[model samples]
Target: MYASLVRSTVALAALCVAYPIQTQASDPAHESHHGKLGTVHFEVACNEAAQREFNLAMAYYHSFVMEQMKAPLERTLQADGSCGMAHWATALASLDNPFGWPGNVSAKTLADGAELMERARKTGLKTQRERDLVDALAVFFKDTEKLNHAARAKALEAALQDVAARYPDDSEATILYSLVLSANFNPADKQYGNQLKAAKQLEAVFAKEPDHPGVTHYLIHSYDYPPLAAHGLEAARRYSKIAPAAAHAQHMPSHIFTRVGAWAESVASNTASANADGGKTWNSPHAYDYMVYAYLQMGQDRAAHLVRDGALSNPTPPDHFAAAFSYASMPARLALERGDWAAAAKLPLTPAAGAYPWAKYPQAEANNAYARALGAAALRDAEGVSAELARLQALRDRATELKLGYWVEQIGIQTDVVRGFSAARSGDVKAGIAALQAAAAREDASEKHAVTPGPLLPAREVLAKVLLDSGDAAGALREFEAVLSKEPNRLRGMAGAALAAERRDDAAKARDYTGKIARQTARADGGVDGTQLARLSVTR
Candidate 1:
């Protein structure tokens, strides 16, 4: 099945290259020219007007700009009500973030998707490829009430695989097949088999359709893991330029940038995304979170604070999970990353009214408790730490009750970190270290969830800090280096390693670590302190 899909994808690519398709109409007033959302050659069975609008909708669909795709798709249907593929595209867009947690998708949305699929079927798709595409997507909306999201996703993946096999020269089918594979990737699978398979197909498609937005965008997603991040650099750098008008495209590259610790590039990409039209709602908060993370990493705390404060003051941020996660995480990250334990401890448990639905997202709520617990531990406030620990436990229990699988585990991990820090602070150093090690091991075994850029503080980095404080310089150095191996150029890891080296009389190693920090933070707005630099002059 995979081989046939690859062959078909290659053939489609050759066709696209030989007969390049114009992505936009020459008429300035035409609604078909939404943005430079990349090229696609989906020849629909519709009138010329509907065809142009359908292509524009397909472009936005390829970039995962579902909201933007809707208007153009509606325009397509208005132009030619008989265009079945337009209905198929509408249903597909309704799926909305294939990897999003199922709970976020309401029953009404599922019912609507099913209705859209039925409408497409009623049109009697003119071409075999169009029929195949509709049939494959129909599986996801079929039996929506009977089958769970995972079950439907699995069925959809199988259906897409079959479509790709049958329509070998259908580039759209091949690209979508790759996307399903990526969406279905198991985070616990250390081998990254699904992601690599998806990337293999995408790379083939990319060779022929270098300007295709979906190819580049999905490729970055496939390689968003630490082990595979460098391989995605090409796609990461190209996607924004290819779909410069897409706010999501501008933001998407930052996923790779965050994974690879390219702080400056991440800051730039997210800044552009945040300044785009989508900045008023979910995308702005999302971009600001990444921007805050990058700014903090570069020792630019002043800039990071500006971004965080601006996002927080947005009177009416969207009540979406993505927005909530970013809004909750930005302040926590700022306080925790800067070692402002007091500030972290004082972080509001929920955003002000009209900001977001914090109650709906337990994971976002957990961020406040987690940061507070860690801060209390750092301050040796045993009572404060215990209270915050209880809050985290309660949040975890709530998440488990809600069947939020990923957030449940994440909260559990946070609980463990807090327990470890509290134990270490209370002089049960042995028990504390053991708890931290267990948490770090569990963290290292799993990949980060898509919703987060990373944990507020990585388990390993916390363990390393505890080790250094306990005078186990060698152990601390080992842990810090381990973190740096996976997250290259991370500021805290470098600083910790430098401190440990200095404590162990390894001046050369300390100097090496400090030099890298100096270069990375050369453009900083003053956040790296003397202690963080381990008393070594970064210049020397």
Candidate 2:
């Protein structure tokens, strides 16, 4: 993750989704689409040969999305007289691919689609449908203004209205549409039964096209989404069968499976590729990150053992450079994430592995992760984290050079949280208070980009804990109460807050929140372990 983005509140409002081309089934008998194709049918080929979703969609699957879309697209075009231009809304959606694939073609497609959609609107599009996928894809992309279940539902419904009407039989649309709709439902708090409806919609898509890639993927996500709806093992089996081999695809699907209870199947593809076979491949570093997560979920000891081993064993393999990285990714990322002095002694090649924080993970997360990895070697490990700390500073400078406010505010947050933690832990009460004030300042500055919450909760907990340890019960009570006001169920935050309130002798506030914390903890399963709970109880 970029260092600058580490503290950002991303405008996750309208950016994640982008439509792409139709692809056919990728699993048809090999003769139909395989092996140095003497007769390569563009539709059924699934190799990672090109960057365009249109290019890969056909190859990855054994069926054709174009065929499913043919009639309605034609009718839509004829209805508006733009040679089915408005029909390409989804294809135009594909233009947003940031990675360089589809090359100039996507650009041309976007320009052309933009003009045509405009012409169609002015020329009186038959239904005025979406007026070129809505002024621009961004308008329909995310509904930032709306926060509740009703708003999310409406925004999602409105986004897919065109696909649902124009291509009723397109299972891809059905699956994708439902996936968007389902994401809004918080399974933990279903002020509406919309989450259940979303699940049924996903089930409907699966019923219609059990093998459809997006449907299968969305089905897994549906099961994982709020409501923790039950998913059949058969569904997992089917997903395992048709899953994409690409690192990108594997990353998401594996996590979805993990979330939905697919266990062993979760990281199968990633671990295989990460284990490597002395050839170039495309299992990405990001994929490696997700693989570690999946492995941890599956209770695999030393989740990233294979990835680090493969990197240490081979310098280069095949596919992309990442496929065969000969040396372990920079000695830096390793020391940050791993805890072995033995691994550190070997030292990976220079220009080590590092990533931009997801704007959500910010530098604070990376720094915290690095700090925790210190374990018994905290003193010696300080040097490596310092180097990373410098890199984080450099990243902020770069973001500043580019005039990226989001990154600046985000990096500031990272600096604040880290500074706050250090100050509070070092027994610098006034300095900790000052650092926390800065932390809140940075977080507030990055509000638009604050889609995912940052370290605000933990930072407050540190301050509150410091106050409690110092016997300033009144100050501790205020800090913890403020934490709860900001984050209703921040595990550690709640725990620290509850304890602080009790210490201040505020019986009612302390008792009410203690019960709330207990209930929230039960719902959170063991994410907040017993040791953590032990810190909060005023009672046995």
lDDT of 2 by residue, 1-540 (tens): 332231121111011101111233343322232221111122211122221232233323221122223333333443335333333333534432211112112235545554655554554433333342344333332333344323533554566755655766655445445655654443234343544566677678667555555555455444543224245334545554454332233434454444343434545644433332112233334344344433322222232344444333434322232222212222333342222333443453322344322232222233332233222122334445456456557656655654444445666566566555455545566886787766655553333111111232245555566577778888877777665454434445555666777777888877776675554333222243432443432111
Task: Write down the TM-score of every candidate.
Answer: 0.90, 0.47
Candidate 1, 354-463: lDDT as tens digits: 45566677778898889999888988898899899888888888877666776788888899999998898789999999999999998887778767788898899889
Q: Residue 126 CA error for candidate 1 (Å)?
A: 2.0
- Candidate 2 residue 11 C-alpha distance from true site, Å: 42
Taking every candidate in turn, the Cα RMSD to the unseen true structure, in Å, is: 9.5, 13.3
Candidate 2 steric clashes: 38
The stretch of ten residues in a row with the least summed lDDT in candidate 1 is 13-22
Q: Which stretches of candidate 2 lie over 4 Å from their true place?
A: 1-30, 33-160, 166-169, 176-200, 219-237, 244-250, 257-265, 272-282, 294-305, 309-413, 429-540
- Every candidate's lDDT: 0.80, 0.41
